[model samples]
Target: MLTKTKAYALKGLEGQAVEIEVDLTPGVPAMEMVGLPDAVVKESKDRVRSAIINSGFDYPIKRITINFAPAETKKEGAIFDLPVAIGILSAYDQIPTNCQDGYVLLGELSLDGSLRKINGLMAILISGLQNGYKKYIVPKENQAEASFVDGIEVYPASNLSEVVNHLSNVSPIPRLETKKFNGKNETSKYGVDFADVKGQLKAKRALEIAVAGGHNVLMVGPPGAGKTMLAKCVLTIMPDLSFEEAVEVTKIHSVAGVLDASQGIVTSRPFRSPHHSITVPALIGGDRRAKPGEVSLAHNGVLFLDEVPEYGRTVLDSLRQPLEDGVVTISRVLQTVEYPACFTLIGSMNPCPCGNYGSKNKECTCSPSQIRNYIGRISGPFLDRIDIQIEVDGISFGEFKDKASGEPSEKIRERVVKVREIERERFKGSKTRTNSEMTNEDIKKYCEVDRESQNLLELSFAKLGLSARAGFRILRVARTIADLEGSDSIKVEHIAEAIQYRSLDKKYWK
Candidate 1:
């Protein structure tokens, strides 16, 4: 007799259907598995055999063969353990075969017949639901994560006996109800507020523009100049993620296995600060499994690279593709997987190796070549992608002593939310959500400049030697600036502010 059961395999973030087929014949006693099973899948035979016998089921001493259909596709992970065990039991008349239809099973089986939670269950459940699979049998631990998806009847089993008994109708298990996700907004209110910063109002303004537009920014300054503090404060002003964006970010983190089990949805935007010594593969995501990297983990959020010049050139440059395409593609011998990498890049660096190249009070200790080499580690192409580059100067003693509080982050966030609302209305029925994501077509259609602003941009472009890409970015930034001011069209002041941001590349890199 032969019995088949449905299962799933994860290929990167996506899921593929796998059919487990078990056969029992009257012959010599043995068990075999086929169909390109990896070491983990192939080793399921021992676990299945032990679990079946330990669970008080008749371990058939006859020739038993199991074949995973779609033999050409490579199946990995221990998620197949439960399905293989159930298939063998059903084939041997331990459970009814008709009971397994219209359901997908995924879980790792312990030797004692206990079910263990497997990684990537959320992605598998979402894929199954999208493919019209209404029923799922998962480990008990994954119940909350799997319940996040609606319109599915989930059965969380703890052991092989419970599953077998439930399927056989000897003891029926109740279907797990879909968790009611209230879909309420849970934005954070406590964080580093911009009002705490003493001075450097210019840098604060630049950060506001960056946050409003979803633009990337780089801050250069001496130590203790509020560069790092300002970067931390930007999170307070960022717009809250929509439900769709939350889903996208949550899916990525779920696949990366970094999601907090208590909070199923990633409510607050992520802020990833990887170390300077991070490898290229670790930064961009590539191992034997090709998992999502830090950038993908920062999707719909921020990737702050502090001490930017200290990082390896290769590792820093590896972000170019994801920066431009909003997705990272990892090509391996077996497959190519693309992960979302759309994120706001906020970076900080010292003026020189000694951190005081152009300081007003301190004398620089590093030589000219040292300064050049330190800044040269970052490539021009990467710098060009950054929309705003501001030099953060040290606050004077008197300014630091001032007791008057500056504008609070809540006030600034209100403006940012309003600006984002303008963008949302402008890009209605389109894919663009922020100024940074606007294409050349969008710039021409929506980011048009007046005669005075056009002349200012052209002269600045000639003097700055800006590329077409930079020019478009400037237009986008100018558009964002105008939106922040509640202006309908780009003005000369907006162009000037946008041009000021491009000065750092000329002052440092040129």
Candidate 2:
């Protein structure tokens, strides 16, 4: 007898269909699993056998060959355990063969006839729906994650016996209900806000611009200047993530297995602050299985690197590709995977070794060579990717003791949301959601400046010794600055404000 069941295999966030074929022939009673399965998939046979017997089902004593069709690609994970077990029972007269049609089964079967939750359930279901399959059988523990995806009927089962009972028409599980996402309602309120921070109005403005346009920022300041505190507030001023953006961000976290199963979705934008001691592979993504790194995990959100210079030179430089390309490709001999890495980078570093190289009150202790070596740790090419570079000086005790907050994050967020609406309408059909993502063609079409702004940019270019890339970055930032004030054209004041952000490198990098 022969039976076939439907399953799925995941490569990155994409789902490929796999047909599990079960053949029961008259020979020595043994089972074999083919089609390039890894360690976890190979171990499912023992689990299947024990689960079937424990669930009060007689194990088939025949030469059973479980062949995962399309035997070319390698399959990983234990997500195929349920389908393989179902195929064996259906091959015999125990379960009806016609019952498993049109449904994609995904679960890891335990030794005692229970089903366990597997990783990447959300991606698998999305891929299944994309491949024209609507019905799914997933673990009960993944019910919350499965509830968010609409247009499908997902039946959550707790054990192998429950799945067998459903297929046998003895009992059936209820379909999962779709949950509506209201980012405003679901968004977690942050404890710290812009109101809590003391001073540094210029730094606050720079952060607002960065968040408004999705640009990267670098803060060069001494210790106790609230660089870290200011970075946390970036999310507060930024608008909530739309439904489409939340799905993209959730897919990466689901595949990386870092998702909060109870929450079932990423309501707020991610703020990932990886330690400085992280390796290049861990930060950029690569291992035995090309998993998502910090950059990919921070997609549609912020990637905060506190004490950016404290990170290794190689690790810091690895961000160059993701920063420019908006994606990281991990290539191995077996296969390769690309993960999205579009994020706003917020980096902080000290001015020198003593953290007071340019302090006005404190006397300079580090020599010129020491200052050069300290700032030189960040390469020129790497620093070029950062669009905003501002120096945050220390504030006096009087500023900290003012007791009155200047501007609340809510007022700042209102302006940011309006700017985002402008960009969405400006680039309605394209992939760009902000001015910073403009290409040369986008720059030419949208960022044309008048004669006064043109002469100001030209003078800054020659006087500051700016590279061609640096000049274009200044133009992108200028476009964002103009958009903040609802200006239709890039004016002189916008260009001048953008120019000052580029001169901080000469102050320290030189």
Candidate 3:
């Protein structure tokens, strides 16, 4: 007897359909799994064997051959365990073969016949739905993840026996209700607020512009200048994630096995702070399985790198491509995968090795060469990508002891949300949601400058020795500053403030 069941496989965020083919014939009792399976898929044969007998179903005593169609593509996970088991029972006449049709089966079966949750369930279901397949049998633990995907009949089962009974019409399983994507309640409120920071009004203004435009920022300061604290508060003023953004984030987290099972969906913008010593693969996304790195995980959110100069030269330079393209491509011998890496980068570093290069109260101890080499750790091209650069100074003793707090994040977020709304109206039919994402054509169209601003920019370009890339970045930042003030066009002051952000490399990197 021959039985065929349907399953799904993932390559990055994309999914491909796989057909599980089970064949039974009279011979010595044994099982074989074929079709380019990896370690996890190859071991499913043993798991399926134990699950069938433990579920109170008679184990087939005939030679069983299970094949995954599309033999050239590699299968990588234990998600095929349930489908292979169901195919065996159907081929042996335990359950009607017709019952498994039109339904996608996905889950990992334990030795005791209970089902376990697997990663990337949301992506598989979305892929199946897009390909005109609907009804699904998934693990009960994954019911929350499946609930968010609409237009599908999802039957979540607990153990192998429940799935067997459902197929046999003995006891039918209940289908999960469709869940609506909620964006309002999904935003997380952190314990630290922007109002907790004291002094550094200039640094606060720079961060406001950064968040309003979705631009990258680099802060140079002493050890206790509150640079890291400012980075944490950026999220508080960030606009909430929309429904579509949340789904994209959820899919990445689900595939990476980092999604909280209870949350079902990611509600807030992600804030990932990876250590500086991270390797290239771990920071950019590659391993034996080619999973997503920290960049992809921070998609649609912030990637905060504290002490930016402490990172290796290779690691810092690897971010150039992803920062420019907004995507990272991982290529393996068998397959290639692309993960979304669109994010706002906020990096911080001290002035020099002694952290007092430009301090007002403390004298510099490090030699000129040591300070030069320390700042040189961050390459020129890497620094060019950062739009806003500011120096944060240590607060005075009286300023720290003052009772007054800085502007709250809620107030800053109100202005930010308003700026984003204006941007939304400006780029209604386009893919860009912020000023930093504007292309060359977008700059010519929306980022137009007045005659005065144009001459000012030209003079700054000549005197500052700025690259063409730096000039475009200045225009983008000026455009964002204009948007924050509800101006119709870029003014001279906007261009001047924007030019100020680009002159930091001369002070530090040079």
User: Tens-digit lDDT track for model 2 on 256-297?
Assistant: 889888877788889999999999988999887888999999
Q: What TM-score do all the candidates reach, one by one? A: 0.94, 0.96, 0.97
lDDT by residue (327-404, candidate 3, tens digit) is 999988778899999999999999899999998868889999999999988976689789999998899998899899
Candidates in order: C-alpha RMSD to true structure? 2.1, 1.6, 1.6
| Candidate 2 accuracy as TM-score | 0.96
Against the reference, the lDDT scores of all candidates come to 0.85, 0.86, 0.88
Using TM-score as the measure, what is the rank order of every candidate, best first?
Answer: 3, 2, 1
Off by over 4 Å in 1: 180-191, 462-465
Error of 3 at 472 (Å): 1.4
1 versus 3: better TM-score goes to: 3
Q: Model 1, range 1-510, lDDT digits (tens) per residue?
A: 999999998878888889988899999999888875457655777788888889999998889888887775546747888988888888888787667888898888888999987777778888888888988888887777777778888988999998888888898778887664443323244456788999889999999999899899999999988898888888788776666677778788877878876666677788898999899888898887888999999998889999999898888889999998889999988778889999999999998989998888678899999999988988766886899989997999999999998898878988988999999899999988889889888988998778998898889878887777778888899999999999998989998999999887677887
